[model samples]
Target chain A: MDLVNALVVFANFVLIPATAYGAQLALGALGVTLIYGILRFSNFAHGDTMAFGTMVTILCTWGLQALGVSFGPLPTALLALPIGIAATAALVLGTDRIVYRFYRRQKAQPTILVIVSLGVMFVMNGIVRLIIGVNDQNFSDGERFVITAREFKAATGLAEGLAIKTTQAVTVVAAIVVVAALFWFLQRTRTGKSMRAFSDNEDLALLSGINPDRVVQITWILAAALAAIAGVLYGLDKSFKPFTYFQLLLPIFAAAIVGGLGSPLGAIAGGFIIAFSEVFVTYAWKKVLGYALPDAWAPDTLVQLLSTDYKFAVSFTILIVVLLFMPTGLFRGKS
Target chain B: MNMRNLMLFAGVAILFVLTGILQSWNLSLSILNMALLSAIMALGVNIQWGYAGLFNTGVMGFTALGGLAVVLVAAQPVPEAWRAGGPGVLLALLVGAGVLAAAIALHKRMPRGRMRTITLLVVLTGGFFLFRALFDPNAEAIEAVNPATSGYMGGLGLPSLWAWPVGGVLAAAAAWGIGKTALGLRSDYLAIATLGIAEIIISVLKNEDWLARGVKNVISLPRPWPVPYEVDLQQDPRFLQVAAEWGFDPVTGSSILVKLLYGGLFVAVLLALIWLSERALNAPWGRMMRAIRDNEVAASAMGKDVTGRHLQVFVIGSAVIGIAGAMMTSMDTQLIPGTYNPLRFTFLVWVMVIVGGSGNNWGAVLGGLLVGWLWLIVESLGPIVMSGVTASMADGPLKAHLVDSAQHMRLLTLGIVLLLVLRFSPRGLIPEK
Candidate 1:
């Protein structure tokens, strides 16, 4: 069926890839939102934090591969993720103690904190580059694809085939697990409740004997863990490059803000929105149209709204639009 | 000036002199020129952040636009490319502008209803397709004209110096648009918006080949007037005689002379800007801006136009950055869009402003010269330093990596310096009096 073929083409190009990308963005946004909620700053260093986590994970993955260890059907990166998260947590905790604690003690303005984070970003960026160099490193060494295009075509007897990469599947699954655990921790746990209370009213929470330092520490650790998992999953899905992770800051910020900064549910929604918009705008829909349309009615041109190069522009435009209409964001987390 | 300020400036001068004594005068002069430019950039940022407390992270974008201005205003025209598709491209741009204007007008005039939304979408979609149809074909034709060199519609072949102000105007226009949209929002929002806009501006520069030949680069741009080429100076008999009298080789004399001329011009510009900025800072308007920055709510209560002042300062600052960017491109004699990155253009300038002393004009100049000199010195010294550190180590991949990654040491050092200053002094080298 031509319609089935069209649907398959749409799923392959737009739906599946966007979902995977959205999951990565959601994980990234979750980290950013958590920081904004608890730390009370946007954390300009978040992208570099992700890069640092990914760098540690990558080094661990390489070490594992050298030791003849792998996850078999999944990437070896999965086995190395926990070590990455732990290392990232340590790094972030150290950074807070050294650089951010002074500012926190000063009770500096959020804008000042943002500038301080820029300094941290530079240092983290340097560390990543020094360790891994500026070149792309591919660490996805196990199964390449869950469903090969040829196999899909043979099974479906359709003109278009739907192929899903193993990384994409893993990204979606890992993201769901992470999000569920995070929600559960936030909703049910005492530390999570304390964090929520602190975020809600810092003075009131302090008055209620909630340890501000502990809340801050837990926030950093959770944020670091999320950043590490997101970074490793993203690196697996695409490729590990420090500059690309740095660039991802724009979209991640866009996602966090659009979802309403400091709102977990909003962050996930914002990520999907940004991812879908970027993919839909940049994707050439000529083939899908050709499959669905009557023979003579098929369009002549590639129906891409914008070039792939302008994908950053798409996310930026969405951010600007959201900022213009809803300064507090979709879920009204904070102004 | 105070004794401390005088000593700081003297220290910067000594550093340059040391560079001249230790390295070649040519290298020292080159560094001086870049430092002068960096000072201008720092002063621009100081105007926004110091005077108005606006956090603009799009300095790279404004600087890149300034570079674009040089190519658009000074480069030799590619007649064939223009003849191929120039008019169509212009028309397409006009149509696009008209569409946006119409949409704005419709939004203002139309009542809030579904009909308005439908009409707006219809107009936008139709205009986009029409614009694309015209733009794509013409751009392709222009790009096809030579495809090797001169594949883009080039400039008016004006004097290169003219591009400096044109660059300011271009950047000012962009800043106006951005400030109009993003000003009056939360401070961090402005920072994020500016960051995103900077990236978009760079992507435009990289992809729009029909404008400036994209990544292929536009080379051999005419130098600003009165700075003669070294070869021309070398060929002059009087110059050669003068060089001989000075006990210098003609080639070396000419190169040094060219750099000196450039340095003189740059110093003139820097002095003029410093004078102007100092005057402005002492003016009543400057007092009002500082007052507004210290407490926006209070300033608003006093009937000051907070957003308007911010937008004004943002534009002025961006214009200054744009001028510096144009000067840089003219000095380089080429426009390489790929080389424009935030680390070099944006955050580095922020460091200079912060390190120099935010609210003081002289402090910015000091910060610029010191940081610029330190940046270059660190770059040259990094490999040597790394090699020295690794000299006692065994020959292995670790040693090799340490040596190879020495270039990245500058970033780490810069970050450390920023953190140290922020933690210790917070007000930078020369605190605001």
Candidate 2:
């Protein structure tokens, strides 16, 4: 075994997992940033929103699976994704109309909106739990791998083997496609520019004859789509659990804040940054290092700085440290 | 303030009576005591939010510390277990402290940018392992004493009553630390920072099995009131006469007697704190705090240090929450760390404060009492609501299924109630002007 062989093995496992995770996080962060920009407060319900979306997707996937509707070498959830996104978007828009619109009319403070989001979070959580119970549901269905680890090792005749799963590749491709769509929607469209103009200066935009309600509506649709996409990706990668999705709220918020809240690109960059750092810092490098190092120099310990269980701590620590240094975040968020 | 106080007092009195009529007296009294504690907590929140307009979202952390205080000060000591591995544990603790100190010192001494980051990171990494090596072994020895019963070092063996005050102090110290770091930042920053710190505190409590026993839980904690042993007095002829006079069964009479005794003690503490806090809020310092909150820039321009005033109030308010925390642990007679989730203790408390008038102490107290009663009843009535709804439906498979699902309606109800309140009245029943 040599360094090059170890690198190949590392790429197959850790890098692939991290990249898939980073893309999912970036999607989640983009949703959060959109809400913070337009609504003007962190949406505590984002996690539950993801759960609600995933719950629909899972149900649809199950229905499709029972009907024998599935793509070969890909999850049946792929067919159910659009249905999930549409349903989720409708639910969110409805919630905005009933719960948030009243307070918006009262001209309530943003903090009040933040508190209202907590209430929404609880409701959404209950709804998801009510429908799916709290148990984790593994709905993944795809080819196990492009090449099994055993086959790869046998074929390469190397000590380190490689296996690339179909789901992982699909996750990365879907993320890139969705992100591209979102960027195109936001940058190349008239409504997208109007939304940005509104978030940047609402008073000026209103004076500029841009319809406030129209801009706000478009923002929610975009946010809901992003959230649904992110939720589906996360549920695909990990199993779908309502509480776990809620727990993801902290990290999602961390990514948004780290990237600079209100900046879509910043959210994406921040998500990847948080995901990669968390994976890297907590990972034990012993296996890869053992293959690379000289026989005498190989160490016994894991050689990790932090434990994997402290992933939340890593995100929070990075957030606090970054906030201490740069309050505006990486991309310098909107005024 | 007087009109608000009168209205609040009337509201609480009515709530107490309504709860007694609707539910049982025992449940009402239980909620009453908690309401009083919630009032204290709200007062703490009011000091920060009402006086200084500073939001401290880490109420759960300081409250948990108060629970820890009960364990530290009131729980009986396990002398044998302490003797076996207590010194080792002590040494491990010292090592842990040394690690933190070294991390801070390294941060200061190292040059800026990459050098500082690298130095701090290296020290932290090394320190983590060194302390873990020391702690894990000692913890194993201590836990080996009696893994099923009393496996670790116990408390100070003081009266349980002392735990309440000690909780306040611990909470205050925690508040001081958090405030020093976060109070100077913007409000939103403070919110996120506080949220992060609260999670960290909960994580520590959940994982530190040696201290809180993590999910294992500590139970049967002693209290400062009369013991149930007094129930045996009913066998006496004289006690029988008393029970007859009360026109109740011996068991009912004795339980109620004990509960009333606890109630009196709790009420006294609650009232004393309320009165003291009220006085403080009306004093010159209180007026200055209000002034600072209204216009921080103007306050600072006029030579009043708004930040410092905010810190002072933040610490005091958090300490009050700590007192409530100790009271809760004592009442439950258990320190179950896993139960301290954000939704229950933290967000619920936020709802109480916001719904209670944010700036008014009386409003807080009233809101606490009303909400606490509502919380208890909501849990009980949630199932009933579901049953009634489902019962009216046609007797089919769907009806049977919905009835079974009724068991999980409380969470939905709670969420709906919160949304309704936020929509109709964000300032609570009485707006704190």
Candidate 3:
């Protein structure tokens, strides 16, 4: 019973929240990795792109709420996700046409493209701020929690209660479904095969009559969709703030690079690795330790490795270690 | 200078003159001072990116370190706080550094095996607990020493100008550590690493209350020598008589005099940097750096230590940025960690560098002045521009929102400017010859 109580406490704080955060990071990493794979440039604008998509989803969610639309037991954001994806796709496609296409034609260096994306990031950031002022916007409306702590305690008859947030559950489910569909599309579809070919060898793919433009377009659309879903889910789990999304760039980039920049499987693994490290290092293990250990052995301190404010440092340390040891990352997608 | 460059500088001068004529002399002088600092920041970036092709997104971190230096070197010491926990805090820091050094030495000396891993873990865990035990209590005590005002151990109370070079050294040390790790990696990896380091530095500044009072801020720092306070100048009879002879109010004259002094100091620093930069660019070392940047493979084949050069340039550039940051903080007479946002400190400087011309020091200075002017002007003009655009529109939330959000237009306008320059004039206004 004591062990079970410890498990409950661990799950409540470390496991569940990390899993939800990991899923959001995985989706975000997948988008970043895909862009790195196909575009051959690190998109500095990716975080702002996520903010733009989330802003659109939030606006649409507000509009739907006004129209008396509701998704019972789930966020109205889920219903608004498709519109967000579509709008994001349109925006990205337009951006590519206007800004990135010229660079592609020039065959500019990747570093140059990165700087160009910084310009795009600025514009997108400004637009988002203009549309939705820089403040926390709470959009999760339908249900707050899947299992309340009090209900969990009553059911389990334990001192420690395990509460699962509705957004967390939805995030994990949505992430799994999205990942599965993405893998299926990439593995089984013809267009996806063409994209793979292009990413593998651009000249060879062109020689074999794979349309470069189409592959680039489809990549942008898929990436935009992924970013939109990830952004909306993240906003639902936490509060939506433009600056926070910008800050998320570090962790997202860490995950993508740690997973191997162009590898999807690596991105998912890297996301979980970063998310778990951040959560575990910051979590105070005192409650769980108190439950698991005998009274005499139990510690009095918080037992946290680092303060929660140092969360970025956790990801950064992990990123540096990975870079030092494995420059090509775990899955060895590309250097 | 060439005709085009001369014309560009002339144009920037005209803008400043126009600001003074149209607005107030105080505003123009303040903008000029800021522009001078921005130019220094841009020059630092140009050294790295233009000379070495290293992408350092951690400019904010270096700048903040400079601000921290000003506090640590110039602010009055909090004797009470030091009495409470100063020695303990120093001992803890030394222990922490010793532990890290020991771990690194162990990693190097010990063979890779399970036993080694176990030993390393034991040492680290024990060290961490030891560190926490020493750190937490001492930090708490330090913070408890009159929490309202002087809760943290303060500086040496040196002249504030000393903080400028100290800031440079502080930033250089940090850059050395970062560059040592990230310089040899993939180009984008360096960018990401720098970006992460910057965020971490900021978080440290925001949370570490025992250092610079964190978010509570450190205000009323002493001014550097040779720049008199406006209040003092106003009280001086000689200054009042001079003001009267010049047909100006003493208050206005005093303020203008103070700004002019600041502007003179800034100009001296900017000119020195440009001269040094020009001399270096003309040297053989500059040629080698450019050669390395243009083709690292060829340069490495020629036996150049590419990574070492990159690290060197990175350190040098960061030191310059640190100096500029310290200067800005001193000018502001306060150190607010919260205000060091990346948009203003990091990317905007990048815009200045890129728009000025990457390989040219003069271009950077011009870019800094022009963009700095535009950034401030946009803020002032945003509402006016929006109101003018919405004058024909009906009174509604949409109009109100647009007018209210006009300040954000600077970002959009900056983006447009960057994109336009990259597209049409990728070399920028003062392209490298």
Candidate 4:
């Protein structure tokens, strides 16, 4: 009956979820944008590569769990994540050298590279499935919540309780830290500038005496590391399943495209836009509406803009609209 | 193109003969038919990538749509279910069409810029609500009647094979729509768009349970061929006689017969498509497509309608894939939406296209059969290959380890095959002119 209490609950549930989701998409979009910049193709396998990286981390998490190691306040998966990043970095570098190198040398079309990545996608998918059967595996081994709903209600003395799960907090923090590091590395580091230079113009970069192989190697490593972090964080926030990663392709790609394909900052912005839109648009704001507006003004209907299931549809529609209006993405790629 | 062509045909025949010797004639024949369908699909890809040099990562979506065509055109209808879903869907479609038309008209008629965009958003959003409001009740009623099996509108009561051409038509139509807008963009744009379209198609198929039974799956679909529900092959003397001659059982003989029937149908379609593709390749149109593909700017300067030609090839190629999907659906006598995954239909088809040779129809056909057979045989073959390699593990748990490893070899083999092919012969087994 209390309007203020309802509004608070709404913010805690809807806004926080959207914010956390936005963080995940932003990180994932950064990974995708990085690869598209240097690799010159939209990798169809990026999602699964993320999955593969997470699977490695999950394995390590289980091993640590078996060894009775605990992060206490944090999920042990957090502890295992760096190791996963290293392993994923190795795998991505190997793929670049072994599979992608030949095509790069031949100067094959970007479309051809995309198809080749599809092949790599299938192989990676099969391997990931083989390693962890096609089922959702939870590896978060920390306390359930930063504040349980009961605890929140008792402290606030309000009808609405704000319960933040440990995993969500970790996901948000990790994403911010990783993204901050990525931007710093991309802008300030020698190798990072080299990647930007190459993405801007290959011939010019080569003329400037930048090593192409070195740039590519660095790009792959960075992309892999980003993918690993994104995958681990998303898996931690939700749950990790091979198929979920495959399905996550839509949202991740949506973020990348909306941000403009080659721009990292754009990718981050695009990801938040998409994630928030998907969350807010599908969110049943009836509860919040009841509180926000006076009794006469409160809507009788669910007032949800779209069903939750149509979340992907919204993302896709946004992408299509953006592509139609601005093919270079919302923020045009750096000239 | 003469002697070598004949030798290639003879080489294929010899391969078939080897299949005859090693596997059952029926099993070999059955695989041949599926392989033929795969080839047809690959040829569709070839026309786009090889001739027009356009990329389409949504082959699976088009194929599934083709399967939908077959179901719509052929399967027997349940009148109640039909009436329930049919009218509601028609209404939904009309409203959707109206919305799209209004959006487009607004785009044209209104002052260009934000005003037009706002008009579109308002109209589209209103239409979506209107469509959903009208759709929900009818869908609920129809689904309620037949909760499990016949949840949606039944198909037109006709021969399911009619679905093949219809599937082609449907796929081509979608291609035209997508290619017209997206094909003009860069390769990466096209890939992303196509991939999105594919996912949308899948989502529709999955959620629109009233249409293709959604994720629940439509099993025991009416087959163009016989279902063989008659006398168990064990009791059939004719099958026994054939089995004895072939060093097989009556059951095997029957399977072979059905497989051969399927194989013949698939090959006929494959040959026809291959012939059509080759003819197109040789035609002036094909040369222009190539010209446009190789250098868009040059071709455009030369007054070639590069985008138009690309749209044509993309549509035609997708139509072929759709037809092939219809054929596969017919072969299985089932339309399982869940079964037709992107990794298989979409990505695998791309592999077939790339490995075969992008522009070469023959290369695509060869690659399809090669990969198709490899995909099927690798499971059994992996163990044998591993057994020979792991003979040194006699003292350890190495044999079991090798066998376990073999289970995962199929994907590894697919990956290795693609990598090796791209590195060595990027053009494929049969390079086009």
Candidate 5:
């Protein structure tokens, strides 16, 4: 019983939250990795892109709410997600045409592209702020929890109880479906193979008659979809704020680089690793320890590896270590 | 000067004069002061990206380090707080460093295997706990010591002037650590690494209440130059007489004089930096840096230590930025770590550098002045433009939204300006020779 209780506590604090967070980060990292793999430049504006998409989703969610639309026991954001993704896809494609195409034609270095992305980041950030002022917007409306702690406690008759949020369940389910579909698309499709080929060797792919423009467009569309879904999920789990999304860039980039920037599998693995580390390190383990240890031997203080405020530091430390030891990342990326 | 460069300077001068005539001398001088500082920041970026091709996206972090220098060098020490935990905190940090050094030595001596990894982890885990054991209590005690005013362990109580070079040194030290790890990587990797470190630095600044009081903020840092209070100046008959002779009101005269003092100090520093920058750019060292930047593999093939040169330039560039940051802290008379947002402090400086011309010092200066002027002007004029567009609209949410949206056009303008410059004059208004 004690063991079960302890496990439940651990699940409540560390396992469940980390899994939800990991799914969100994994989705975000996938978008970043896809772009880096194909475009051959780190999109610093990726976070702002996420923010812009999430903003669109939030606005649409509100519009739907006003129109008396609702998703039973789930966030109405799910219903609005497709429209958000489409809008974001158009925006990204337009940006590529207007700004990035010029640099691509010039045969500019990747660093120049990265700087141009910074410009795009600013523009996107400005647009997001203009549309939705820089404040926390809580738009997640519906059933709050899939399994309330009270319900769990009543069922289990344990000292500790686990609560699963509706958003958390939706995030996991949605992520699995999206990731599975993405994998299927990448593995089973000719266009996907061409994208992989183009990423592998651009010159060879070009000579082999791969439509570079189509691959680029497809990559942007997929990235925008992933970014939009990830952003909306994250905002539902937490709250929508433009600046927080911008701050998410570090962890997202960290996950991509840690996973191997150009490798899809590596990004997913890296995201989970980062999410788990951040959650586990910052979690105060006194309650679980108290349940596990003999009464006198139980720790008095919260045995946290670091404070929660140092969450970014956790990802950063991991990123630095990964970069130092394995520049190509966990999987062999472009070294 | 070249004709293009001369014209750019003339344009900046005219903008400042217009600001003075249209607005007030105080506002004009204020903008000039910030522009001068922005120019310094731009110059620092020019050294890295312009010379050595290092994408340092951590300008805000280095600037924050400079702010930390101001707090450390100038703020009055809290004796009671120090007494509570100062030695213990110092010893814990030393022990933390020692533990890491020992772990590194152990890892190096041992074979690369599981045993080494286990030993290293053991040492690190033990050290972390031991370090925490010493650190937490002292931190709590220190924080508890007069929590309202000076709960944190304070600084050296030295004059503000000492902070400028100290800030440079501190930021240089941080840059050295970052560059040592990151400079060998690709440009994008360096950008990511720098950005991560910067965010980590900011998180530390925000969370570590013991250091610079964190979000509580340390205000009214001592200034070196004379800052005449307008009321005090007005009370002085000799000051009134001087103001009368100068055909200036006492209030405006005092404010203008104070700004002029800052302007004079800022110019002195800017001129010194420019002189040094020009000398270095003309030197063979500068040529090697440019060569390394243009083609790293070729430079390496020529037996140049590419990473070493990159590190050197990175350090120098960060040091210059740190100096500017320290100067900015002094100008504001406070150190608010919360205000050091990467968007405002880091990316804006990059815009200045890129728009000015990456490789040219004069271009950087011009870009800084021009961009800074535009930043302020757009911010002031955005509402008017928005209102004009909304003139046909009814008084409602849409109109209100448009007005608010105008306020955000500064960022939009910044992006458009940057993209346009990159497209039209990729080399900048004053192309590098």
Candidate 6:
């Protein structure tokens, strides 16, 4: 096989999946970091929120499909995403009003708020599971792959074939658009600037006549939107399962922390870093290495650093390393 | 100890009695036994969160370690598997430890430059491969012994009761390591770090098949009590008379007796822990911990090693959880690694501690019993309520689906309970004195 073919194979297996996963994580991390910045607590319910949103989107997608609605080349889930975001935003805002507002008024410790979020996590997790039983749900209804492995192999006349899923491409593009919108809002828009001000210095922002509650409401709304998008993208790419989303909490938190808890840029950077590291470490690279190296240097084993089962371990390790060296994360935040 | 505490405890007793009346005593006793263990876990969490104000979200990890302890200390050893590669496994473990030590030493000794980094990486990279080379084959050989049942190298062939305290010790050791790295961070970071560590511990437990049989599970763990089995109790002369007097058959009576015996053991352990915790809480050390928790800056200014205190409490609390975990395994008579989820093992305990009372030992126990009982009751009640609600609906897939979805109501109820408690009684039911 040609070097181009080998590179394509490696990219297909490792790079593409990681990029898609990274985008999903980045969006999730952004929501996490935003909450951390504004709310002054690590929202433990983030994963569950994602799951809840995804569950809503799936339900909506099913409803739409039942009504004979389709997105042609794109997944029907994409059409249902905005509705999902709206439902999620309402859910989050309602939770904040009922559960979190009391704590905020009490001026309770961040730990207490964290505990409250855990409560929210349970509620959201339960609601998601209740609405859509705890089995995997596939909602993607479109072309499965942008380029199939067989088609690529036929075109390239190579032994190795490269396949890219449509969902993966959608995830990356949606993530970019979301990140761009978020940054522009934060830097160039009125509400976004007010949020940054509040995040930077809550008291000063309050003194400047910024409605703290308004900023908080907007933050939750934005976070809910991001969480919904990320959740749907992930569900489209991989099957949607409630427990898997809960498990995603660790890696998402890792990404947010490694990027710096309240820094958007850091969260994005950390997401890619965590995703790539997890993918690369667990990946068996022997085939790609064999193709890249000379015939004399072809390896016998899989040449994997760690098994795929230890993917969580990879993210944990990276998180610990980051926490040890740069506790503020790669990008600085209030902490 | 006081009248209010007594009343609160009486309330719990009334609930238990209600459960016994509504359900069978056997089921109630099972709930009680689990509540007793959960109280121990809540006590552990209380020690950390209440006494030291440390946010530890890694209860599942410590609990898993406790489970691991059972497997290591009690299970019947697979001699053939051990003989096949036991030394190799031991040597591999040693190499791994040595590599870590050497790398740390090299980093500290060598100048903070590229040479030091390169040397450390080289040592680590080479050691990992070497260790794996030695470990993987032995692990495969050990796992290959009896793939269906005892593929893993079993425990030390000791009485399983020994595993309880040993589990505590093992968990304490893990906690100490975790605390060393994590205790210095902010509360949120510490929470995330502990969570990550817990995940790592679980991954190890689930993936390392040679050690604990992984997902295949290690069943028939030895119990501390010598209570007769249901069948044997039916044959027993004394038990038959007792069962006859109680107006019950042998099987049910025997099961209740076994559960009661286990409950007795658990109660003894719980009392001992509470006594120790109470003593500690009232003493100068406990006061110091509360002082540190309340105002770390002032405590540190007064020359207290804040992180050290946090670490101490963290280890002690985790050890208590570890003991409870081991006890839980003994109760189940099996070590199922897959069953340890954060929602069940970790967060539920937090709710227990919080709903019980954060700083009070009695509050934790009361909360544990209350939440544990509710958790069980809600699970059963959800379907009943759902069926009742959906009864009016026509018999179709929609109605059937609604009834099926009711199982999830337990978690929602738990969340609502926790939120309500936090909202109305921020100090919990049995507030700290």
What ordering of candidates by lDDT runs from best to worst? 1, 3, 6, 5, 4, 2
TM-score of 2: 0.90
The residue ranges of model 4 lying beyond 4 angstroms of the native Cα positions read A1-6, A290-309, B1-20, B225-251, B380-407
Off by over 4 Å in 6: B244-247
After superposing candidate 5, which stretches have Cα over 4 Å from the reference? B226-232, B388-392
State which docking tier applies to candidate 4. Answer: acceptable
Tens-place lDDT per residue, model 4, B287-405, is: 88888988999999999987788888889989998999888888887787777777678767777877777787777887788776666556546788888788767756656655666
The predicted structure with the larger TM-score, 2 or 4, is 4
Please provide TM-scores, in order, for all candidate models, with all chains considered together. 0.99, 0.90, 0.98, 0.92, 0.98, 0.98
Better of 4 and 6 by DockQ: 6
Ten residues in a row with the worst lDDT in model 6 chain A? Answer: A1-10
Instruction: Looking at model 1 chain B, report the run of 10 residues with the lowest lDDT sum.
Output: B424-433
Positional deviation of residue A124's Cα in model 1 after best superposition, in angstroms: 0.7
Chain B TM-score, structure 2 = 0.90
> Which portions of model 3 show Cα errors greater than 4 Å?
none
Give the per-residue lDDT of model 2 (tens digit) for A1-335.
Answer: 48887697678757988888888889899999998888787788888889988899999999999998888888888889889889888988999999888877778776667878888888888788778777889998967677777898999888777887777777799989989988887789988888888889888988999987777777778778788878888887778888789778777888888899999999989998888888888888888888788878887877675657667777888888777678778999842
Each candidate's fnat, listed in order, reads 0.70, 0.35, 0.77, 0.36, 0.73, 0.77
For residues A168-256, could you state the per-residue lDDT of candidate 4 as single tens digits? 88878888888888889888998888889999999999999999999988888888888888899889889999888987888898898
Candidate 2 docking band:
acceptable
Please say which candidate is ahead in DockQ: 3 or 4: 3
Q: What are the per-residue Cα lDDT tens digits for candidate 5 across A1-335? A: 26787899999999999999999999999999999999989999999999999999999999999999999889999999999999999999999999998888778899999999999999999999998988899999999999999999999898888999999999999999999999998989999999999999999999999999999999999999999999999999999999999999999999999999999999899999999999999999999988887788888998998989999989988988898889989998776
How does model 6 score by TM-score? 0.98
Better of 2 and 4 by lDDT: 4
- How high is the CA lDDT of each candidate model? 0.93, 0.80, 0.92, 0.81, 0.91, 0.91
Q: Just chain B of model 5: what TM-score?
A: 0.96
Q: Could you report the DockQ of all the candidates, in the order they appear? A: 0.83, 0.49, 0.86, 0.47, 0.80, 0.80
Give the poorly placed runs of model 1, Cα more than 4 Å off: none
